[model samples]
Structure formats: C-alpha cells, structure tokens
Target: MDQAPGSPQGPQDAPSLPKCYRHPDRDTGISCTRCERPICTECMISASVGFQCPECVRTGSGTGHAPDANRPRTIAGGSITDDSFLVTKILIGINVAVFVMVLALGERFLAETELIGYAYSPQLSEIVGVAHGQWYRLVTAVFLHQELPHILFNMLGLWFLGRIVEPALGRSRFIAVYLLSGLGGSALAYLLAAPNQPSLGASGAIFGLMGAFAVLARRTNIDMRPVLIILAVSLVLTFTRPDISWEGHIGGLVAGALITLGLVYAPRDRRTLVQLATCAAVLLLILATVVGRTVSLT
Candidate 1:
C-alpha cells in the first residue's frame, strides 16, 4: 500500500535512495569529493590526495597528477630514452628515404651507390675506395639496396632485430654496434672480394645483429640452440648463394659478437669505460685492416 501524495499516512514511505552515477541501479551513500555525485565503491580509485571517482582519476591524469608506468625510462646515463625504439625507427626511415631517392635517380645512380672494390674501376668515383676519399661508402653502402625485395627483407630483419637489440643495448651502444658491424662487413668485403666485384646491402648489419643476439643469449645462459641454428642456416646460405658476399657476412658476424662480448663481460666497476674501450679497440683494428689491405693493393 502506498501513501497518497501530500496526505498524512500511518507509516511514511522511505526516502528514495541515491544511485551511483556510473551504475545507476546501484544504491550508494558514497559520493565523489570533486563532483559530489553518488558513486559505488567499485568506482573509487586510490589517489595521493584522497580516494577519487574514476572520472576524477582520469581528470587528474590529464592534469599530470597520475604516474604513467608505461612511459619509457631514460637509460645509459640518459643518453638514450627507452622511449619506444626511436633509434630503430629512425634507421628504418633513413633506409627507406635512401631507397626512394635511388629509385628516383635511376639505374645509373643506383650503380654508383654500390660498394664496389677500389681496384674495379676508376670510372665510378662513388664506389667505395680504401685509398680514395670515398671511404664513407663503408657506412653508406649499408643504407643502399639494389632491389625492392632486397630492401624489404633487410628492413624486415632490422625491424625485428633492432627492436630486440636496441632496447637491450640502449640507443647509443646499439648504434655503435650497427655502424661498427657494417664497417666490419665492408672492410672484409674490401679485403677479400675481387677488386672488380660490386656489392651492396644491409645483410651484413643484419647478420651482425644475429651474432649479437647469439652472444647475449649465450652470456645470459639462455638456450641458444635457436640462435645458433639460425646463424648456421645464414652461414650456409652465405656460402651457397653465388651472389651473396660471404666475406661481409662473416666479418659483420664476428664484429657483432665481439662487441656484445665486451658489453656483456665488462666488470661491474668502470663498466662503461670498459665497453667504450672495447668498441674503440674493435674500430681501430678494422681501420688498421683497411689501411693494410689498401697499401697491399697500392
């Protein structure tokens, strides 16, 4: 039985209860401090100031009151921000841009961009030269790709490997490993390939990443069978493929392994110094090898 409106009754009807804003059916005595709206316990969020409703929490986040755990942290003395594989993305962008430029320039420009042996021809001055001023080819050749498939495969490999390696090593060291590995590949190619032979691609750097992965895995005592198997398959392909530069592949692999070894095995004390020294030593060795090989050619 209900009481008539504005009529005195034997028993007054209970007052209507407040409902949660989010869950309207849910009756609640609690209300949000900011909005003063009724809210259920489930809608409550812990806050430094006090308990807040979800809406208030979201508003606080927009005002920089919330801590975002997902944000990337700085590493390597803040030299690299672990802020979403930025170095890897930049590398990919540069590679793609260069590829586009090469396509626009045509086959003649593409041939000129190749890492040709110094002894091959005086006609293509852009070809990498050990004795000439075109030594930049050691690094530049890694960015050049001859075909669509070539860049596609190499970029895919880089995307896969860079995501893993860059995060582990941070941006600066990862870049160092990449450039050194590429230089190593070019160095060996210069030393071993026929003076007339021309080769270009990022396969060397990719192989270097594989080698680094293997070394890091081994040092960490992680099962390395998969890495080793992949490495073996790559080595087999390098040897069997008539067009592949086995010298570059092997050189890059060795360089990557050595660099990672230094990084992994460095003593806890003066660790950064040791790693830097190790990289410096590797670079000097590669430079010496290039100089010696060039003198021999002369």
Candidate 2:
C-alpha cells in the first residue's frame, strides 16, 4: 500500500491515455461516436451526434446515407444507379418489337397498324370515320415503320436523344413527353394531310425529344447553336422531301417544347403539381384538336 519516493506506480495507480487507432503513437482523447474507436482530430469528421472516424463515415455513406444537394440524385432522391436510362431502353425495345411484328405480319398488318383513314388519307370520306374504331392508331402508328431505312433512322434518333433527355427528365416525365408528342404528330397529320394517306414511324416522337432537349439546354443557359442547326436541318427535310410528314414533325416539336417549358419553369415550391398540370394540359389540347378534326371530317 505504501510506495517509496520516485518508485514506479502499479498499473492501477495511474490513468491510461488512449491512442489514436489510425496513428497508434498519437494520444487522442477523442473516440468515434459510432464505432467507439479512438481517433485524432485529423481523422475525425463531425457527425450529428459527435465526431466519427473516417472509416465509419465511409461505411455510413455506403449504407444509404443521404447525399448532399450537389451530388447526382435519382428521381426518388436516392443515389444514381446503372438503370438511369431504363425508360429509354424500354421505349426502344417496344419500337423494335413492333417493327419485327410488322415484318412477320406483312403489308396488311402494317396498313392496319399505321394511322390511316380520314385523318391520314386524302381520298377517304370524312363522314365514314375510322373503321372498326381504330382510334389507337394515333398512338400506335408511332411504333410502326415499313422500311428498314425508316426504322433505322428513327431508332438512331431515339437512341441518341433518349440517352440525353431521359436522365434529365426522369422515367415518367420522359415517357409522357414521348407518347404525347407522338399523339400530337398523328393529330396534326390527320388535320393537314390527305384523309386517306397513311403515316407511320417514330419521327414525331424523336422530333419531340429533340425539342425537349433544346428547351432544357435553354433553361440551363447552354449554347443553342447546335440545337438550332439540327432543328433547322430537320425542318428543311420535312418540307423538301415529299415523303416526309412535315405536319407530324411540326406538331411534335410544338408539343414537346410546351411540355418541357412547363416542367423546367415550374415554381420550386410546387414543382411536381405544376409540371403534371402543364403536361396534362398539353395532352388535353392534343386530344381536343383530334376531336375537332374528326368532327370536321364527319
């Protein structure tokens, strides 16, 4: 119980200082709040509860911790994954599948699938209306292309534009824009082209994506020269080429631009609501145009 002067004390007689786990030689009074490992100030990161070691911070990040605003975020506010372009892939798949079906089923099938009759053709009587109520032709025609070259060009456009636009707009909004733009094209063709003329292909939707891309670029204040050039070339092709559906291209461009305008310009406080309303209104306008054309033809 008694010690002589200058004699070493027993282990229990003196308090032990903790050393940093990372730097064993360095004495650190601090311990990680999560892992409880001793860490020096240099190895510690401030956490909500207390200081955490670098290893614990990394581990927590891997386990679903929320990222800061500057990091890339998915539609659900999670980390970006490999399937960011899933919707675009699915659209391309559907278009390819339908083209295959057209090849297998022959000309009759292609004729039936494309948007036809009063709106699409010139010779058909307005009063006759769409045979067997094939109202879906307005949408389905977008996926049907007759020639190899036609499908190739459209799919290439989709692949290029989809990759750029899909990630920016998210899955739902991108798909909505594509489908609605296709419908808008069909409606325009019905109103402008010969009543009996049949039209098919994804050009309308592709053009729509182009338009959306232009709007997005403008919103972000990027250079518009490239977009403007592409658009001008496409418009020239539409007008100069007798076979091209100029009406469809113009309609889709307008529709896509309007929809993207609403999405990009929405107020931060009610972004989702405003975006949905904007897209819905564009779709309704397309539907109304189709109905009005149908009545005129009748």
Candidate 3:
C-alpha cells in the first residue's frame, strides 16, 4: 500500500491528482465544471457537462438553467435549494461539536469562549474577555452552550423556526439573519451587561429565527399564532429567569425583525442590492456599538 516518493509507477504519483481547493487535505482529479476548482467527491455537484462545486451551482453561473422559469428562486432573489433544512441542520451540528469540544477541554475552553466584556477567569489565571481584545468571544459564544437543556431548547427552537424561515428567505438570507441576530445579541450583552458577567447560548440567534418567521408568516399569509405565542412565552422567561441574558435576547429579536423586513419588502428590481445593503448597515451598526463599548471598557 506504500510507495516511494519517486518510484514513478503508482496511482499516488500520478500528476493528474491535485489537492481539493476547498478541502486541501484530500487529493482529487475531478474539478468543478463551472469554476474549475479542484473538488473532492464530497464537494462535487453533478452537472450537464461535468461536476461543479456547490457555490457555482448555487449562486454562480448555473449548469443548464436556460429558462428563467425553470430557475426557481427564493423570496430574497437567491436560488432555491432542494433541502430547505440543510442550513439549520448544519447549525445544530456546529453547536453540538463545539459543546463536545468544551466537554473534552473543560472550563478553560468555556472560559475562553463565553461572552464577557471583561471577566477574570480562575481557570485561565488572568483577566480574560472581549475588553482584553478577545473579540472572537462574541461569535464563539453564540454557539457555545454549557448545559444540555440549554442547547436542546435552543436547537429545538432553531429546528422549528429555521424550517419556517430558511425556506421563505432562502439559505443565504436566512443564515445572514441568523448570524446577525446572534451578533446583535452578543453586542447588546457586551454593551449593557456587567463586564464581569459572562453569558453564552444560541437563544439570541433562535429568537432571531422566531422574529424572522413572524415577519415571513405575515408576508406569506402563514399562521402567526405559533410564533407569537412561543415568542411571548420565551420573552417572559427571559425577563424572569435568573442568569439569563435579556439584552442579547431582545437585541437578536429586534435585529432579526429588521433584517427580515428588508428582505421580504425589497423591490423586485433591486432586491439583492437592498438586501446586501440592509445586512451591511446592521452589521456596521453592531460593530460600531461593540467598538464604543470596548473603548469604554478598555
């Protein structure tokens, strides 16, 4: 099974094999038909001529969608995917994976990731948090969950709400909304919560999905009672529950609603630009606030 580096007589030595562009660890001869990037079997997309990468098939030049009608689209002018729940599933997997990592690595990992403007960590034996320029905590904490019940509740909400929102807004916009909501939640906690008070969870992001679902339900004539009822209950709990980050939850809800409003109401002729601009503006505002808070803390 093994061969010398310069034996000049094995498949492993074949010049045809090249490392996949997306996953560089593996070698693949097959390339994307559209982008011509080296792609492994996992990343290949079957096309009329040859296999293409997922990116090329999704938003880039399509394989054989000559007719506009055949090329179905999402409400936000994105290509409709065959699996509406793929993004949601992926999000859950990521959260679970991170949770497993935290379990394996112990409190050190959790201390490093949990959102805090400035909190001294007993595990780390020093001052740790966003104010010390560990800005990635804002993002990592969104997916980090210390308790089983916390993740299960948020993932359940994500599963139901994501199924509703992702299909309506398309994968790109749905994820954009989801991430923005998470960041909005983190930013608010950083700005308003005690600097030493660390908080972490997907609640901010899930609240965002719920908010987006409500917006889409109204626009598409779906029943809004389910979302409203759940949202009301969740908010009540957020305010009453001990150790909960209320600021993050409220921020995510507001951000999700604002982003979805732009998505579902953009003019058809310029939907893409408006959507991009809207997400960008919200992201900039979030960043500006975070910067201001960081400056204040530091």
Query: Deviation in angstroms for 95 in model 1?
Result: 1.1
Candidate that scores best on TM-score: 3
lDDT of 2 by residue, 170-223 (tens): 677788889988888888887788777788889989899989988866754446
> Candidate 2 has what TM-score?
0.72
Reference-based lDDT, residue 77, model 1 = 18
Off by over 4 Å in 3: 1-70
- For model 3, the local distance difference test gives 0.83
Question: Model 2: how far is 38 from its true place, Å?
Answer: 38
Which of the predicted structures, 1 or 2, would earn the higher TM-score when compared with the native? 2
Q: Quote the positional error of residue 203 for candidate 3 in Å.
A: 0.6
* Model 1: CA > 4 A from native: 1-82, 120-128
Ranked by lDDT, the better of candidates 1 and 3 is 3
Local distance difference test, each candidate: 0.74, 0.75, 0.83
94 Cα displacement, candidate 2 (Å) = 0.9
- The TM-scores, one per candidate, come to 0.71, 0.72, 0.77
Residue pairs in clash, model 3: none
Best by lDDT, which number? 3
